[model samples]
Target: MAVFSLMLVVFSLTTGEFVVSGILPDLAAGLGVPLSAAGLLTTAYAAGMIVGGPVVTLLTARVSRKPLIIGLVATSVLANAASAIAPGYAVLLVSRMLAGLVVATFFAVAIATAASTARPGKQASTVGKVVLGLNLGIVLGAPLGTFVGQHLGWRATFWSVAAAAALALLTVLRFVPDRPSATTGPVAGELRVFADRRVQLAIALTAVGNTGVLTVFTYLAPLLTEVGGFPPGAVPVLLLGYGAGAVLGNAVGGRLADRALLPSLAGLLATLVVVLGLAWLGGGHPVATVVSTVLLGALAFAIVPGMQTRVITAAGAAPTLAVAVNASGYQLAAAFAGWLGGQVVDSGAGLRAIYPVAAALTVAGLGIALYSLRRDRRESSAQGSLPGGRSRTS
Candidate 1:
């Protein structure tokens, strides 16, 4: 039931975050705003995630996880409703910002619920299910909302998202179990994961991986339409294919991580670099571009669950803060990638340039993955040297 509730929340949050992109043109026209101004719907959401994740995580650290999730979902539903009925563009922006903050809170609560809901070794699998919601949303929600917007208008998109959020709120209220109170500590305790080397590596890797993908995904529609010469209507199909691939990759990634963490992480990162680079240079051929795009989506998502597992394991007892921080890093990376890619587009480099930059960042991430593996090996070797040989490392 917790998993079911989380899946719904993930679907709603993911849809609400990226749905604006699909209907950007229509939204701009209906609101009588510039396309760039409408883009703030995404930017405001991203900005709110950056601020809300830590703030909410800390402020609600002492609160029960079940109640936190329920409240966040309810807040998200109201915000989406507000967005749907906003009297003007400015009010819509405010609505999105509110929604974004709630989404951030959801991220922390959802992961904690997923992790604690399970027994010790089952942590990764449980949390993976929760994170899977985000992947499903990224893969399904945005495009689905976009398609709905085409016929029903942009306001319908928010209405649908609000409905989803409301459903999630009810599910969480009915299903998720209440957690014990969090330990009382200064707020610094939540931020302490930053001091751990392996934890920092995991966060850095997540940021790098996210930056690589967003740099390309942020401009996907334009690339497919303008560069690949794909029909306008075909964009959603391509996006759906990408989402499907991410779902596949995420499942496979979890299995591999359970056996050997570093090997899984390295393979996914390496595959992403190759696939994204090919996507950069493959734009002239429509089939090849779509294949590479799906591969890019799959490979990037493949890293998410495994990397999250690595963060939790590395942080030991502080897994909650570690997971929350990882969520923040992921959003931060997307914002950075989108901004940097915008610079490339503004300079007349065209959408094709975005993937090549993405490819480069992915390659850099592969390097980070390698360093993390070597560190893991060293830590293992050190544990072997202990007299009792009980394996003190997490």
Candidate 2:
């Protein structure tokens, strides 16, 4: 019940975050802005997350996890309500930014809480359950919200999110316990976890790797309609396929990561490179494009559990702050990728070019993963050897 409650909180948060993707056209048309300008909504939301994750984590370091979760959900409800009733583009952007801030804090705290609740050695699996909420939001919530937005109005979508969040808040308040953090250190002490080389590498890998996925995902609607020759109405269906793949990938990746973290990370990044490469080549054909979208979603999300587990383990005593920083890294990468994709579209390079760019980013991330893996093995070998060249444990 507790786990389910946490999932609902994450679901509501993620739906609010991603629902904009499906309704960008509606939002643009309603506001009388260009697509590029509407794209700024994504950028603004990510920028708020990038800035808010660490800041909120620092400020709330001493707060109990349960109340903090409740408060964040309440904030989300208000933000979405504001979004639903915003008078103009500027007002809507402000609402998104506020929502982003609360959502980032919610994820960092909620993931930490979920992981801490796990039985020994099953941390990734527990965390993955929470992440499943995120995938489910992508799978069920976003498309449903998109459908509502299309039929009613985009503002109606935010209203739906606000109501969902309100329900999640009640569930969380009732079911989830107040789990105190293991690290009771001051904010400065918690921040010091960034000094670890492994944690640092994990953050970089997360940012670079996630940028690959977001680069393509941020522009998927336009690519499908304009380049793949799909009707605009088909976008939700395609996203549903993509989201289903993400659900499978998230489950598999979490279990695999629990068994072999580094190998799982490297393998998933390699898969992303291949999937995006295929997407780049096959995006112009209808069937191929749909298949590639599903594959891309799966391969891209498969890296998340491993990467997140790596950061939590590497950070040792300061997992909360570490996870918050990692979330910030993802949003920073997403913000940059969103902006870059917009520029690519505006440059008249066409929608097909975005997939190749995404592939390149994944390749870069794969290189980092390999480098981190090698470093880990070398360190492990060094720790195992004794002063006289004997096995330390034996």
Candidate 3:
């Protein structure tokens, strides 16, 4: 029940973050801004996340988990409500940023809480369940919000998000308990996780992997319409397919992480390379494009659970700060990937080129994962040779 509540909170928070992409057209038209200016709303939110994750996590490092989560959910409610009622583009932008701040803090804490609450050895699986909410937001919330915006108004989408956040806040208040801190270490000690080579590699893997996925995802609508020959109206249905794939991938990845972390991570990254390559090559065929898109979504998300588990385990006592930093890396990479995709489109390279670009990023991530895996093996061998004959890497 507690895990389910946390998932709801994350779902509501992530939905508020991603729903903007699906409704950008309506939002721009309603606010009397150009599409490019409206796109800045996403950029502002990412900026807030990049800044908020560490700051909020560090400030609340000593606080109990339950109240901290509740406070973040409350902030989300106010932010989305402000977004729904904002008088101008500027106000809406600020509201979006506030919403972003809530997401960064909320996810970091919520994920750690979920992992801590799980039965022994099921940390990654529990974290995966919580992350399923984020995937559902992308799968269901964005399209639903888009549908609502198209039929009603852009502001209605924000209102719906506010309502979801309110419901999530209630769930957290009702079900989540005030647990002890995940760490007894001070802020300085928590921040030292960055010094670990494995942690650094895991963070890099997340950033690069996310960049690969978002680069293609940020331009999925155009890719489908122009390259796949799908009408604009069909986008929601296609996004649904992608989201379904993501949900499946999240579940599978979590189970695999619990059993074989490194192999699963490597396999997922390699799968992304193949998926994106196929997406680029087969993009001209509608059926092929749809299949590739769904596969791409699955392979891309399948890497997340293993990555998150790897980071938390690697960080040892400082999982909260480490996870927050990882979240920040994801947001920063997303901001960069969005810009990179725009540049590809603007430079006459066309949407098809974006897939290859994404593939290259995944290849980079795969390289990092392999390096980390090899290092782990060497450390295990060394630990096995020690006097006690116990492997420290294990």
Q: Compare the candidates by lDDT and give the number of the best one.
A: 3
In candidate 3, what are the lDDT values of residues 111-196, reduced to their tens digit? 88888888888988899999999898888787788788889899999999999989988888889978876556676677777999
Candidate 1 accuracy as lDDT: 0.82
Computed on alpha carbons, the lDDT of every model, listed in order, comes to 0.82, 0.86, 0.87
Q: Rank the candidates by TM-score, best first.
A: 3, 1, 2
Ranking by lDDT: 3, 2, 1
* Candidate 2 per-residue C-alpha lDDT over 1-394 given as tens digits, one digit per residue, 9 for 90 to 100: 7888888988988888888977999999998999988888877788778888889888888888887888888989999999999999999999899988876778878778878788887888788888899999988988789999999999999999999999988888788989875457666788778989999999998999789789988788898898888999898789889888898888888898989888888888888888787877777889999998888778777788888888888988888788888998887887788789988888998888898888888889888899999998887788667577655565
**2 or 3, which is superior by lDDT?**
3
Off by over 4 Å in 2: 21-40, 85-91, 151-155, 343-349, 387-394
- The true-versus-predicted C-alpha distance at residue 128 of model 1, in Å, is 2.7
Best candidate (score: TM-score): 3
Better of 1 and 3 by lDDT: 3
Q: TM-score of every model?
A: 0.92, 0.90, 0.95
Candidate 2, pairs of clashing residues:
none
Evaluated at residue 260, the lDDT of candidate 1 is 78
